[model samples]
Target chain A: MTGITLAVPSKGRLEELTREWFAANGLVITRPGGARSYLGAIEGLPEVTVRFFPASEIARELIRGNVDFGVTGRDLIHETSETGPQSVAIARPLGFGNADVVVAVPDAWIDVTRMHDLADVASDFRSRHGRWLRIATKYITITRQHFARFGIAEYRIVESLGATEAAPASGVADIIVDITTTGSTLTANALRVLEDGVLLQSEACLIVSRTAKFSARRRAQLDSVLSRLGAEVSL
Target chain B: MTNAAFRRTNLEALVEAQGATRATPPLLLPADPYFDLAGEEFGRRLLLTTATTGAEYCLRPDFTLPIVTDYIANGVGQPAAFSYLGPIFRQREDGPAEFDQAGIELLAQPDGDVALDQVFTFARAALDMFGVSPNIRLGGVGLFEALLAQADMPAPWRSRIRHRFGHPEALERLLKRLAVSHDTKPQKQPSRADLVTDITEQMVAAGLSLAEGRTPEEIADRYLEKQALNDAHVPAETLALLHEYLAISGPVLQSLTRIEALAASRRLMLGAPIRAIRRHLNGLGEARVTFDASFSPRLDYYTGIVFEMTGRTGDVLASGGQYDRLLERLGAQAPIAASGCSVWIDRLEAEFRQ
Candidate 1:
């Protein structure tokens, strides 16, 4: 309906950083209806309409082709893509909001150091404990893919909505697949990452939906935004 | 022949001749057993929904789990056989999410070979009536476990290798890792009995609630296991022999002979299981069957014989195996002697179309 629909984080430091990132690239984003408004526009690019959304919601919107482009974490892109990686393409990594999706166990369990060791623990977990090894994670799809790759199938996932690092100590899960920005929380929680357990190194990324209908004019409008941002990537 | 008519006459007759009673497991089942028993990859494909109670339920992904649950819950003390024919639901990338399948499960069957023969013969008979003679590939976990036991590694290494049986690539990776000797770091250690309390205190100090995590004892036991694993290395000669053994695949009897030769060369006794496999295959008396030493079903539960019947294009038409551990995992008080097979009518129809 519009020229190019671009979605960014609706609030907080991510929104501020996003605005600054755009401003530093010579494009000023203005909230047309003021600070509380979700609608916005670029200073000189009327062809681009800016909509603010919760970062996770932005990933879903991009996947559904409701937005031409969105800035969301790469973790969300992989987690939300039901089909596969081909459903969405990374236009650029913004380099902020950096974190890693990793598999971590309690530091006290020093014997486990790698995914191969984790597989051993998972296989013997049920017989030793009378239940499957419980992994706490919000990233179910990513975790499933990683575990399946290692041929580790004897674990169950306990969905963690908050404080995934605490899952092991909190008695809800035996291990965790979680996003960590710094190693502090894991250490404070007495957990250590497996030697080869980093499933994804993610940051804020400008992602384009391959499934989206990109008309010629819309493509041109997108090009204009990318050009002004000084971060042009073929969509 | 139409699949429905085939199911009504030939399929029903075949199952009836085996004395398998008709069974209808509920289409919607509690989701935990599937994820817990069948593993997450299989669980993820389930079309899942949540009830008001917040319990997750899924459309039956297959008849095996649900039928087994029913048998454990309501089965009489005597041995029993069950036949099921209906739609099973799963989210497929290439085809319909729901398809028709027919299968039988034999429970409390004291004889493994007898059970294997009955299920295989019945499944083959049903396929023959449909005029589809698919190539048969046979495998089993029992023989591999027997070999690993003879290999004489530590329990942790043996269990890990046994768990990774059937997945050749994973097994290869495990073997490579096993060949390397791990260096255990020098550190002051707590006694196993004290380690649980120490870890729990550490968690508490970190301001974590301990009610939901794995029991502290479980963590400590794993730590002890990790120390044990650190000190152990699978010997090179054993690894070489295993590599040779896993590569043994061909006509069933020939494969068995190769396995026997390998075991004898190492002066290791493989004992009854290898002979049992040989006798089992010889008893099959089926010309088309072959064996692959590394093959096992996708589901991790099969503990003994596993086989798949595939059409010319390699589309699996019927498959099943011995899941002796499955009943116990599903909460049986005692391990029940169990084995069975399932035939996919949809895949059979594909064969007919061809």
Candidate 2:
């Protein structure tokens, strides 16, 4: 019998939240070879094999159709996926992992408050510095799409693989588009989100790979999981 | 790279015959200086910051920038043609991130008839090496600007649309916003035209002018002109017609006819630019090319007649276009009539791989 595969974050708060959500929905997930193992299963549902990966990898796997279903943030999926007929169906939304991808700049740039102001600063900065302004973010696609919307072409995306909010202070970048749960981190760093700079308001989502080969048994497995999660109404 | 050049003898011969001198570019590129302006896709694919100095660098991504900078540095005032065989680094989803490329960049060239012929000659030679009569698609960033000029579109909307021209999705978003803006036109006291005339009279009476070079009358006239155009509103029907205009493609003559019909139906006087395009096509003579009203390159610099040659199997063998604005930004005293094409050597090799 062909079984459906599901991927979730293997570690951290996301892992805990995924487990708690599953348990609350009447599905207990556990590692067959103890807590350290990456391999897991839905306690009562043996046909749905659970594989654990890092949070970002789960998004990749879902998009690649390497996994039938996966749990990841909407920001990651939006940043990674193309704006077309998506290969991964954004099947369900989980109540946790809420964050907004916002465009943040240092608070001292008093002349800037909106995206148009940022565009002004960008061109002005280029004239003074002889180079386009750098905006740090791992959300390259989303950031690019957002900035392009405002006719802001005088900026660059620097891939911030670390603390993105600290980029302006470090002098590594002039601005940032980062996922923020609260305004505190940006505030603590003396940064302010632009008035029109919220690129995306993201949260945890259950993504299903539309490109996946869903056999009769696998489809049945997915239906069982969705129904358990109370997403049958949407389906 | 040399071996790839050796394999691409036909391309080299063509470049030499066209009178381009060979040039070399430095291997290490300063990423910070170039990354911000390389467009979204290029910015994403770059290899950044060397481990020690933390200074960002990338393998040379294209020859155009280096060629432009080199020309400026050398104080070459007159127009020149140059060719090079080199390696360009870009992240790829399906294949090697680094590959050999051979291309010729013709700078400060005459545009229209001359540019059309030069582009055709260069592109035809490259296609000949692949031994494939491929589909040709032509587009120009200028085409849109020409269309906008006919309709009294507001300055801000026109500039925004033109700025986002190469980006298809962004253009669509801007168009959608424009469509909605029609419903939100704020009511105003005194006709914008009458208000402008009032302001112009007031300013004349005060004997004061706007900052910079503009006179009070000129400034009032300009703003009122913009507001009057705004009052007219960019209608949904016009946007829909533009969508249909953008969708016009296939045969060169057929595409021209479609553009003419679109202009006629929409009441847009796209006569001059349309005729210029017609001239470019007719100038190309026997070169097999198709006009696609919708085509735009990912690179934002291109301002006219963009094109790509595909192999029989649908691989982009070479692509480039007129980038007059880029030359000025690259330190030219003023905009130059520049256009060039880059032939992907690896893609050419792959075309013959089977």
Tens-place lDDT per residue, model 2, B147-168, is 8666555555565556566666
- Show model 2 residue runs off by greater than 4 Å: A1-15, A25-72, A77-93, A102-136, A145-154, A158-176, A181-201, A205-235, B1-7, B49-51, B110-116, B179-250, B257-276, B298-300, B349-354
| Among all candidates shown, the one with the greatest lDDT | 1
Model 1 lDDT tens row, B32-122: 8888887787888888999999999999888888878878888535788888888999887643488888888998887877988888887
Let me know the TM-score candidate 2 reaches against the reference structure. Answer: 0.70
Query: What value does the lDDT take at residue B256 in candidate 1?
Result: 78
How would you encode candidate 2's per-residue C-alpha lDDT over A1-235 as one tens digit per residue? 4888999899889999998998998989887776579999998787889999988888778777788898899888778755412667777789899999999876544345777557545644555566667789998878876776776667767789889887766667777899899899888877789998898998988888877778777787798888788764222
The i-RMS of candidate 1 is 2.6
Q: Each candidate's fnat, in order?
A: 0.63, 0.12
CA RMSD of all predictions? 3.1, 8.4
